[model samples]
Target: MFALLPLRRLLICCLSLLALAGCDRPSAIALDQQVYIWQRQWRAAHAQALVASHADFSTLRVLVAQAHPNEGWIQARIDNDLLRQDGRPLIAVIRLDGQLPRLDSSAIDQHIQTTVRNWQASGLNLRGVEIDHDCANNRLSAYAQLLHTVRAELPAGLTLSITALPAWLSSKALPTVLQEVDSSVLQVHAVSRPEAGLFDAQLALRWANAYGAVSSKPFHLALPAYGVALTENGDVESEAPLPQGGSRRELHAKPEDVAKLLRDMQAAPVPHLTGLIWFRLPLAGDRRAWPLVTLQAVLHQQPLRSNLQVTVQQQGELFELRLVNSGNLSAALPTLIRNDAAHCESGDGVQGYRLQRAANTLEFVRQSPGQLAAGQSRALGWLRCSQLDHGGFRVSP
Candidate 1:
């Protein structure tokens, strides 16, 4: 018995090393482009930059939504193919309805099988499939069974993955649920009540570390890459102005917020960490979101840049001061713009702009520090005078 001790120790050591390798932190992350509305292009150049910044692959969201509780699934079509066929593998993301019934799993599975097969036939190379379901914690068993059904029908050699919730990790059924899928994505960013903010960096770190300690399955961390404009009436809009939604209170994670998340992950990486996937890819119209450079910087663990360019432009009847961020991160503006012979007034529906009178100069002050995101430009306010390049009317440094 004593002679077998060394051999047993060696076996244990080998198993430990294999486990460590499986849990190694991500070297390459992925990007998810959820195409819900019509877009003119895919921004292939930006995607190429993402790949150059250690992005592994792109997952295009092909929504499999249900019109009614009992009705069949309706597959949303991809509009403008922004990504070029550059031989990089793409994953087809199938998102089901949050309130979808467990009884409909059979039909959903069949639809998924047909949908994936059709995607394969479209001449686009596919790397795998990801099913996004926001099922309740108690229903994990049913979800697990559904996953098994879907896996059995998937084409051989194709990978299968799922988007998992933080709450699911603590449930007793998570282990068995994990066994059904090849990989899982832990989503850390989500919409919360307006008062609670959009994301919590500390909470995300704790959850990521906890998952690493429990599960041995390879998983990706999903972070938010998009922003939403939430209004007083609780209406949400993305990128563009919402005419019917009234004034918007922007809810988004700044570049520094995302940077902190990345740093926290590196400090305490999950054991089974495969990679990361941004919640949704940014397009040109997504003015409230982070730019490609910012995303690249976060992935590479580089410091964010601050480049704010100020300019004045005249409209039909009004002259406005425009502030643009040209760097990789957002910045709080210089509070005051002082000029001796000019009167500045906040534009209609604009908050945070006020004017103060000094002995000889008028100080146009931004009462609240508003964040201006990189690559996004906004009109600060209008000047009562139409003269351009007024010497005394310069912004405070």
Candidate 2:
């Protein structure tokens, strides 16, 4: 008994060391949480929100939805909607179902953290952090472990959420919800079906109940407002900017159909609905879809325009650019053509515009699409080039 005392003490010391090592593991939730934090900071510095109340992640510029009244919005226009409130934390999105963007965890962490911090320094308030991505039911264990590691690393007060598929909540995977998530979100828009189709709204509601039952936190459900335009066979028609939402134009959905869908949602009973998230803002609601242009006046400060489209194809013998200039007369005047996607342009037949040549290609130096007379349209001459590998050809005017 006397000899066992030292051995027992040694055993206890070893056990304590083991516990400390376990505690030192990084938290997966925390890692992603930081990513969201950096994104919020970036948004605050980069983008300006229309509604001065709170940062609206639901805006078209979702990626940079961290801007607010105090922080100035970036002069550039890159439309996205990820935050609904002003200067809030970024919702860092990572797709777990598919192959990893890259294998190295360090690489992933560095990239994510750098992005989040850059955003935060920009002036946006880093409040709510979210990761929007898909994960399989069977692989939930690995994902849960990752989340646990991340949660350990993340700072307090930063909200964490994950996007879960309907199949994940199906009978078998439903039970593991408690082990995996802090808060959950159900994406009503289905991305996958191995054989036939996705779970309906009723089925989705049941999954929500099951998920909410298992987890202690309050989870939210996300649904699309303008993203559900379908073809004759229920396939997505076209992913265009919800008329005037962003750069999207030449969409197929009829103007009247916008309000019609809203009416249907209101009539149907969506229960346990903490809040409704329009999956996307600018892409779903544009000036045409609404009455008297309330959304446009409030959201978009200037005239709405369809995204500039440039189609490069072989026409007869000369290289051709099938361009669609979409915007009302209010945006700008169009005078000269410019191509910036490629540093080279084929300005064989135009004057007053600048062009640069490098190695073996001609590039457009500047653009003045706004120079065109408002409401009027014109097509400049094409460059006659038989060049086979013309991969660097684009048109902008």
Candidate 3:
């Protein structure tokens, strides 16, 4: 009996050691999701409310905007109506302006801790905190120090993550920076130059490989579902400053374009890549973002087809040319509408559409680019033609 008891003890110890080793290992390879809520309001009637109900996400990162260098972070308050009783975890995101002065690390830490406490007191599901600073490469070392301090100050069971720019992958301080955080989100979609596209698939692949080869901690790729537009302020000799939110010169990326990029990344994924985190959760009131249905199509690898219909309405002296989209997604407005005719001119919405004379045809071009949504139509301008019916007008991208 004594000999049997010693053998049983030995086997139990061996099993416990194996269990500890398994616990220390990396988590299972499973697909997860994280979403960002950039806006302040989160009412039950918000578009994100529908998204939250439909999406299979693990977390929601809420934006805390800091307007100026010295301004305190403005944290967003979540409406209980928008979240379920047992909702997905929340990550408080602090967005700092690139041009802001260096922040006091101690003060920032206190601010974050206080914010976390407040969220906890509000009966919210707070999980982590993320820094969304586009720090310069030269300032990476300092940024690393700040991250370390912030990580240390975080409460038990809470994590620290940061948004990493592509430039950070090549910095010497990247290793030091990653050492302090639980994970990082690399923003693959960006609009640096006003004329550049929303994202570059090739560039994103290169960054994924480079960062994956060096990064020790798991990272997620951040993508955009929104659009941007750049307009000149005035007819100045030099370039003018970019417009504010109220400006109408916004640009957008087609849902097809974003889908193609996502497919490329999926085809050639990197190691330690956690998952994708969309730049924003679109709201019903947002004019610059694609609809949630379009975003879902992209996620499911569905292609968007353009359905353009041109109709003519006779309004006494002139005919109005209208373009309509009756498909599942949006269609980019053509730069010009051409017809080999003599009597076509600008329509009633001439401020947004212009008249141009081609070599053999009259053309009406859009003064600004716009997106035509499904079941939506826009009047290009008034067409002055003898016949009332639509005849020879063709759209050109």
Q: What is each predicted model's overall lDDT from 0 to 1?
A: 0.66, 0.42, 0.73
Count of clashes in candidate 3: 6
Q: Rank candidates, TM-score, best first.
A: 1, 3, 2
Residue lDDT tens for model 1, 86-169: 344566667665776554667777777776777677666666778887878898898889889889988998888888888887
Off by over 4 Å in 3: 1-31, 41-48, 51-53, 70-72, 84-86, 233-249, 308-326, 333-370, 374-397
Candidate 2 stretches with Cα past 4 Å from truth are: 1-61, 64-90, 95-104, 171-180, 191-200, 228-273, 283-397
Clashes of each: 3, 56, 6
Best by TM-score: 1
Cα misplacement distance, residue 196 of candidate 3 (Å): 3.1
Q: Candidate 2, TM-score vs. the true structure? A: 0.43
**What lDDT tens digits, residue by residue, belong to model 3 across residues 180-275?**
899999887763554566677677778877888878889998878777655455221111234343444555666766677667766655778878
- Over the stretch 1-397, how does candidate 2's per-residue lDDT look in tens digits? 3555687889999999999999997532210111111122233323332343233333121343222234422222332332333434345443332444322334334444654575566554444445454655666666666665555555576555566666675546554543555666666545554123322445455555565555566556654323233333434423332332323222222222323333343444333334334333332223222211222322222443433443456665566553344443222323333443232234443323345555565554344433321222334335555453444445434
lDDT of 1: 0.66
Candidate 3 Cα RMSD (Å): 11.2
Candidate 1 structure, TM-score to reference: 0.72
| Worst lDDT 10-window in candidate 3 | 234-243
